[model samples]
Target: MESSTRTGFAKRRRSLQGPFLSEDNIDVQSDVYIWNSLLSGYAKSSMFNEALDVFRRLLNCPICVADSYTYPNVIKACGALGIEFHGRMIHGVVVKSGYVCDVVVASSLVGMYAKFNLFGDSRILALSLQNDVVLCKSLINVYFACKDHCSARLVSENNIDVQSDVYIWNSLLSGYAKSSMFNEALEVFRRLLNCPFCVADSYTYPNVIKACGALGREFHGRVIHSVVVKSEHVCDVVVASSLVGMYAKFNLLGDSVQVFDEMPERDVACWNAVMSCFYQSGEAEKALELFDRRF
Candidate 1:
């Protein structure tokens, strides 16, 4: 049986190489796996039309019942093509197949619906995930993308315990920052600091610094600066860039310059940050000189 399966796969590969690998020649019972493999191949190659064609063909195949793997790949194809109707159809299949409760499938549905701006369906699907941290984060991100800060906060507050992982805290803080709830984001940042063994990543500090910049909360930014120094994460380009940007936003051009100078490594963004500070402070000539040197 294994040898026959190998032979079938080899034949399928050869058939695939031909110009006319049509549905007529494929033995439905023996070729179901091959068809699914081809569908995945098409999806991975970004051949959305071909992937959908294979998916549609699979729907009619007697041997190919829509399963967990099949639905996720087709949903991904729908997402890639921005085909909301197709996604909804796949959602229906998910429900019919009793796969809606599958965490992986449910998460894919949430991501697909979110990408297509189907927030209602996305929220419903997201809430159904039992213990999926990534799905919860994706749902928070979707709400954040939709500019529904209240809903995002509610999702985070309800689904995420105080003992949630750093990724969850970062996601919640990022959602707050994106919504311009700088004070709330700062509060969360403080709470994160209090968590035992909780250390901020490049993502955590940048968003928090951005919140400080947006709110003109330079004192808060300074305190964060102290933390960054103590944590030895100050060398991260993103953190340094955010610090420069935060100082610049508060009209502290001198402080911005000082931070820029102290950065161990500099990127184009860091150069831009300093140049922006100079320009915003009415030192256009210095800004131009810096830009010229950097470029």
Candidate 2:
């Protein structure tokens, strides 16, 4: 009954908001809810700075009290901007407001801490919640961000459902690539190919191709090229660039040249890949020829 009343009140308040504000006669309590709504909307729309702006305004208004919904959005903005001090301030507010136990706000705090590479804090916050899949996923992402692949793998392996999660696979692939663990990245891709749990997408193909290039694994590169073609992502700029780079890195100039020529539209990256291929393969003249034609 109380929930229904609040919802109806919110609906009526939303309708009255513009008129009330225009008249500068909105009640203080309505102003708090309106600010919370604005802050949440801004954060959800990825307008982090604007969310922070509204947050600051809310802070200056003594009549407005920060609620559970308000803290998460504010913390999200702080996280997105990597503002640790502001996040900490919001955390303190959350604790005093007794909102630290709220799952949504807690998850946001965990995610924010993880974003800033505060792995220990993230871990502690994540563990406070039980049977929360969202929190577990955030914890997995935190480990990945920390480059603790062992811990990440452990978490992923322990979570039975995450095995079929494409985002988890993408995170692991990205983590491996970022850490220069090219061989491990390829291995993960190989596993991904065999698993019926998930299928490769544009994001997956490019990273795996990059790993193949780094390892000079021409055969693996060929296999991935076929997969890319079968996946019908051949024209994707990022995948195409990775293919060009992979072929070039293996000194397979002909295949690299063919891929470059086949691109329907060439970006600067494609051109750079073709030129770098020749340059890296000790074909300076060919590299210069391509460079000259690029003008």
Candidate 3:
């Protein structure tokens, strides 16, 4: 009964909000509290579209600005709705509005990515806030915790630590790889090889390997494998899994199997990768056999 009353109140408030402000001689542009309440009501009632509409109204209202109080439940709505394009746009606004550093707003953004696994959207959002190191670090940590190392590889971002050559070079490598500019990716990798300050870590090999695979340059991939082996960075699960896929992409079944077999531990992704490699290579029995071993 009480829940129904709250819903009724929310509905009536939506209808009468403008008139109530006008009648009360309140400046709609200055009364952010009213707008926030409306947003909260719509979001709490699961009226996500309505809440976003209210946000649009708030944005359209002259001289009005959203405060720290405005974003949590609304962002929750975005996550509930899969953090769509609108959410990404709003995040850009949040950064510009300088509310991104607000603990509540930060939490909501983190929750949107962390709870929903919208790493792609989250990564985009994180990259947009190039000026806020704290929020970027927070979001980046979440991506790393989720083992989404690719997202950590950074896009075409320049603001992140120019002092760290590895960070900058990796960003170039990853940005090129992500954009499917395989030649550019390899160029960056090759350049990094000569840079005394930039040593490619486990973080660096996956995208470089992916580019080699994309270009179908198995020889280049093998050369990188040699570098990884010499650098003693071949043991990481991510890099090892990438090697498995890269060798498989080259149709080097023996090489792919050798890489897979050498892993000290196998995650589900690594297991699925090798199975798919086997299945694609017309080794159905072997795929099933591997599945049984996994079980």
Model 1 global lDDT (CA atoms, 0 to 1): 0.76
What residue pairs clash in candidate 1, if any at all?
A: none
> Model 2 over residues 115-204: C-alpha lDDT tens digits?
897877766565554245555555556566656566555555544466677776777788788889888888888888877777878888
Clash pairs detected, candidate 3: none
Estimate, for each residue in 1-295, the C-alpha lDDT of model 1 and write its tens digit: 6566555645664467343345455554345566667777666666677778877767876655666777777888898899989888888988988988765677677778777877776766665662566666666676676675655555555444423667877998988877778898998898789777466777789999999899887788899999998888899998999899899899898899899989888988889888998998999999998788876
The 10 consecutive residues of candidate 1 with the worst lDDT sum are 17-26
Question: Candidate 3: which stretches are off by over 4 Å?
Answer: 1-171
Q: Judge candidate 3 at residue 113 and give its lDDT.
A: 76
Query: How well does candidate 3 match the true structure in TM-score terms?
Result: 0.54
In order of TM-score, best first, we have: 1, 2, 3
Residue 68 of model 3: what lDDT?
80
For each candidate, the alpha-carbon lDDT, in order, equals 0.76, 0.77, 0.74
Between 2 and 3, whose TM-score is larger? 2
lDDT of 2 at 147: 62
Alpha-carbon deviation at 278 in model 2, angstroms: 1.6
Regions of model 1 farther than 4 Å from truth = 1-23, 28-57, 67-69, 72-92, 95-104, 111-124, 148-151, 158-163, 176-184, 194-197, 288-295
